[model samples]
Target: MTTTELAPETTGAPTRPGLTPAGLVTVLLGAALPIIDFFIVNVALPTIDADLHASTATLELVVAAYGIAYAVLLVVGGRLGDSFGRRRLFVTGLWLFTLTSLACGIAPTAGTLVVARAAQGAASALLLPQVLSIIQATTSGEKRSRALGLFGATGGISSVVGQLLGGGLVAADLWGTGWRPIFLVNVPIGLVVLVMARKLPESRAHNPLGVDRLGTALLAVTLLSLLIPLMEGRALGWPVWSIALLIVSPVAAVAFVHVERRLERNGGTPLLPPSVMRLPSVRRGLMVAVPFFGAFGSFMFVFAMTLQEGLHFGPLGAGGALTPLAVAYFTVSMLSSRLVARYGQKVVPLGGAITATGMVALLCTTLSAWPHVTILELAPSMVAIGVGNALAMTTLFRIVLSHVPTDLAGVGSGVMTTNQQTSLALGVATLGSLYAALSASLGSRDAFALVIGAVAVLAAIVAITGRRLPDPRA
Candidate 1:
């Protein structure tokens, strides 16, 4: 009769054979590890470069390489999970991620480390999409909402915690590994996950399906052409080839859309089905996710650089500043189910307002203490940002997946993850570059803080606008 009553009927199906609460936690943990790794290295980069004698350009490559690869392959990874079994791919991905982390830790040369990081990113691509699909397929109703909130919380907290943990490990220099501990630490955690995952259940489409090779290829090509130039073009002095590749992205993207539509018309399994785009909730949520995630990436990248290079903080001090944010994010995320269920879409706009206020606080802190602000000075802003992020992210995720039929769950998961990852890469490329370009003229400290504040404001705008979107059922 009403939305609340309808949700129970829709989501309350019998539990599958092995999909227990423990199993769901394991999947969420698996999802968090890779995301944590993604941002953890930011605070550790200076130490990594100094110890390995890596060139400045090579150091940038270390971060960009992993992210670019991870972003490019996420869609395909989701498809693989759909065609194969999510549990099988999840276990396989966990083992590979563990091995690659070991490789990264042991790598002697900068080149070797870069290669290992690329492998790690690839492994992550395989692992992350399955986490979402597993949750989507297994849980529903309050259970689904709670699980998704945890996933969102884990993602937000991982970015902050990764930096903090990286800093601590580098400072501790555990096992005489120096910067190596950052990567090595994942090995034991990953191994534990692998053992636990065996108890995880298998989940596939209700009906088996064929892989979409052409759609996958086109998606990869389109993303690569876009991110590669944006990440490296400036470092390479904007080479002719870089410009050419940048130009090719839109063309490739258009071609990808045409091909997918044509294939879908012919009764083919397009990587991204045209029909899904017609869903108002999925389409609008995605539009907001791109810019929102972009800002999140930029904030992490730029803030880490500021704390380290501009303020002369050590790795630990730089990372410690974000701890408050992480704690706040976790608290709010754990409580998100109650808030969202009651408030519905209103939760998103409120989050934006909160986040915008946090940015303002951060801006003030930077201006007042310019070259001497302590971690304590940044705490207020960090907490606000965390709370706001928890609210916006948890709500956005639910909206995106709300209308997905069980049959198309994998593709839905893939599309959402792709949007998030691509936007993250874009955030770092666009905002990081702008900060660098303005550093000399505006001064690094002032320019960095100003740029992040501006972007945060922009993100808040997008979030508020997202509140106007039609509900998923409509």
Candidate 2:
């Protein structure tokens, strides 16, 4: 696969309505909703627990269940979009997400809410893959770069906005529904998205491959086994089943690899095309994405809790605190394309080092201020983190998708999205669990800062390693 050979496969034209700025905004909004929902719920969870009287284990499940289901099914969702139509899947997923969100809002018990959240995650999986695929299949050059940058910004911005808005909704208890408002708020927005999506052109692979049922199941099982225990085990005191599940994760994952290999060798479409795994750019990019997203997930989850439970900030306060991050992320993300073009791959590692510095600053500030610090005090560090995230996050997306062939765009998008979702879930589970465990001994606030700071350092290491990867051009 030389550069010339890959060049033809990368060219694409934007869909009819999607070619316009309004169309781009519509598509981006549809894409942003799902990502936003994933993180927004973190802030509202405490409110849900208090209002609904849900236990800690159930609350953990509420978050983890959604994340795991979304991660597992994302590849399948991408394939479905390819076989059917990206526009079709987008509309269907959005409607389902809206409905499920309503169910989540109205649920009377913790179990029901968790189930609804899982359904929401599944709908999200269906909706999200098509976003990148649509962008890949429908746009090229400056248009592609701009759309991708918006996607990157949306991802980082949503995490911050989700927390902020979730806090506002829960606190305002709009229409006196308390935490229910958080879920119900999506309905009107979904309806608008549905209409806009219908006007958007449909796109799909000319010759779509059949779904890989076995690979999908195995991937789901592997992720669930690994993620479930990590998220729930600590809160539940490390139960026997949790430990057992952790032990079984590797076995399940190994089994999955074997199954995928057999499928590929036999000429069947595996969940992820095996050829993708062999691509140097794809492989290295995934390696970089995993720890990066994992740390990201853990950071959002822990920070949400730290503000609410540890620092006793109100919903508005917690959400408001993240504003600096959102601003910084968007500002710096806009500059990432130019940076990558000029600086090449080194920009990513630079982003990581800057992010590391921000985290270190935050940790120091938090440790010194303890229970007395306000959002204003955290603003400077938050802005730095946001700037760092903006640079690294956008670069990561571009790097991963940079060399993918348009023919296999669907699966390629799926692979990258699944890696992201899984890492995010794992981050929340593993790093979140670490924070929870350490909080018991070190006090909640300090424990969270310490754990998050450590994870950020590790993410910096991953970024530095990514700098060594051969550029797609190379």
Candidate 3:
């Protein structure tokens, strides 16, 4: 569709409590919690394994289960929020996340923790979509754009903090609790958000669509079919069932699209509106988002293990290593919105190139340092990576949601978040699995560098694809 066609005229939708600044902070806190938990487990993996006497593959399951469950349920969660109420669903999700986190904290075994983590992921799925949907439905023009920028900043900052805090929490051993405090920390935070969230505005589609059970099931099936095999296949030594499931994934995805299309045609609500998928902004923005987030996930997972298991750093030492990245991401992200206003679509690919440059530096540094790699040696590259991440991340969300009709905010945000979460999970399952496999054969340093190289290549591709983004003036 033409730009003129895509930009729908504004309407005067009823607002609740004026979507106050305090309320926005509350929702962003809710956003930080889930994203934080997703990566926080990276540092704690070794501690959990030692504490529970779990196998390496089982530990992988601890991460994979949460990620997969989050990815699969995110879209449906968005649909529910759209149909019922955004504030209601967001609060409910936050409360459930708190309880599931507690379950993770006190779990007696790795299996129990894995189950609890999956529950936490589901709860996160419910909470995160609303942050963007609410912003999309309630705000517009520069305010909406800036809110989206902060969402991206919140995501990047949380990731860095998650890595940093996971190690800190593990090392502090609060009340001799070790890693338990990481999960337990959410309890008090959630309670506060629930209270503050009472002031947040509520909005939904004027003509809400009914839930599509068949499409939702098919989407779940499709994502699981792909993820289960990639994540578990390596651990199981490539079993037939894993290969079979991988083969079935594409078929499941096609079936899901057919179902969504049919639902839309029949005047029924689909899990994701097919019309949204056709938007140029979404199609192009994803080309950058997938690689950006996938590389990010792999970096966090690989670097945590490399620092602790390969280099023998202590928990705090490991977390401290990521501080540079956090600083750089926050610094650059704060500037990204202004840059976008000045540079428009060009800033995204430029950011990708810079990010890749950092990865390349990291690859060289890792190969040079080998087994004795230190945090100081990694700092410059980490800062570079952070810059790239901030620039691309801030604009990508705005680009994807730019043309979405206000009424479809929930579903649009759901689809956007689902892509991000799914890519993140895939990064762990695919690149993470690759790192693990190569670490066994190529040795730790070489394996880590090779993955960095792979990441750099992916970033370069994002830069090339990002040029296709619709012009801001359009």
Candidate 4:
């Protein structure tokens, strides 16, 4: 009855209807917007602070709220898509995202914007999982790998573009508008995606499970218990409530797993299928994803803060600094699928090594130049990280869901994305907290060097851990 003694499941050839040229575009476009929006606000946060005279706490909420809501809802959203139809949920989510974007753009106060960001995050939670589910349900083998590659590539491209665009839009100060354009710009893109979605294929779980209301509620509470404390504890100076919540988080997590197991044992539906957790592909892949994305999320937030506040760089300057990273990611990711096919999961460790080297270079450069670092000095390291990430992302995604059954595509995709999103939030919370605490006394440059050096160390761990990934070629 041991895990190793269990027989492997083989799915010979992909039999499902394939993704069309236009349909692939639709889902990926749907994916790109939310991801771009996720970090687009990073460069714009300073502008928002000045415009609304918002406190540091509220600004942190502006970013944390969206990430938290998105992470919490993703699994349930994926389950809903399985039962009700992915296309329907995707369209609905897109419309909601579009409307919320408009709301964010027009908000008159920081509080209103914060609420809008939360709503937008919820919409994103609905939209994003379907993209993965659809691909999982439809494509298989090399096609699945390629589609997922594009999705990961989209992640890199959109994030950099978001930062770049946010800086440009804020600088343009078009019609005297400032950071509003970052959110407002999504309206048109959402419209195009919605239009394209009409032509996309409609697919869902062939044997869809009913909604697990209890499990859903428990999952949300568990994530919130962890997320709220980590995100707020530092800014609030680690209040008693924050400490209490942090202590409760592991208990809630345990409860969640227990309840889910009981539900599955009783033959009732569960949010996280216990059988899925038994899959090494799913379980171990999660271990790799959490740390990798945690590093990425924290790096984005910390670097953005350092770039603008510490270096006194304009939004444009900060955005431009990441261009090399974006270029390298897009270029390398395009080839990662082939590499994944050739080398299997080894690409992930290789990527982690390269990215770690890049981080080390960045840390050294920052220390050497102090606050006077230029874009030219930063480019090589940025590109190295980009290349490393590109290799890992596409391959890791393929490996994570490599063994998921077609009938459980929604659930599996949901689980992967939920981990991905939650890890990002954790990254922001932990790394960001460390940076904020260190910045209180140390010079910003020194603090940044240490934190980024930590990020490099994180990458190294992920690389070492990545050797455990299920070899797709096996």
1-474 in candidate 1: lDDT tens per residue? 000001112222434773688998798789888867866788887788778987545665677667766766766676677678888988888988999999999999998998899899888878877786677677767887888667766766776678688889888888677889888889999999998998887777555445677777777778778766776787679999989998888998999999989988998867678887668778988888777778777787778778877887888997798778878877887787688788877787788788888888898888889889889889999999889887787677778778877566556656676677667767777777777667757888778877877777776786678788655434
Model 1 earns a TM-score of: 0.87
What TM-score does model 2 achieve against the real structure?
0.89
For lDDT, the strongest prediction is 4
Comparing 3 and 4 by TM-score, which wins? Answer: 3
lDDT of 3: 0.78
* Top candidate by TM-score: 2
Q: Where is the poorest 10-residue window by lDDT in model 1?
A: 1-10
Candidate-wise lDDT, in order: 0.76, 0.76, 0.78, 0.79
Number of clashes found in candidate 1: 0
lDDT of 2 by residue, 1-474 (tens): 000001123324555555556667777787778767765687787788788887655666787788778877877777787789888998898999999989998999998998999999899878877777777677778888888677766766776678678888888988778888888888989888888876777877666678888888888888878877777776777899989998888998998899999999998878777788788778888888778778777887778778888888877888888778877887777787788888777777887777788888888788899888789889998998888777777676667667777666556666776777777777777777777778778889768767877777776886678787656444
lDDT: the better of candidates 2 and 4: 4
Task: Encode model 4's per-residue lDDT on 1-474: one tens digit a residue.
Answer: 000000011212333456787899998888888867866788887788889987555676688778777866777677677678778999999999999999999999998998999899899878877887777666778888888677767877787777688889988988988889898999999998899888766776655567777777777777778877776777778899999988888888888899989989998868678888789998999889888988988888888888888887878888888778878887887787689888999999999999899999988887788679898998899899889888887687778778887555556766776677778777877878778778878968878888998999999998999998999766
State every prediction's TM-score relative to the real structure.
Answer: 0.87, 0.89, 0.89, 0.88
Point out where model 1 deviates above 4 Å. Answer: 1-28, 52-61, 109-112, 132-161, 199-203, 440-442, 472-474
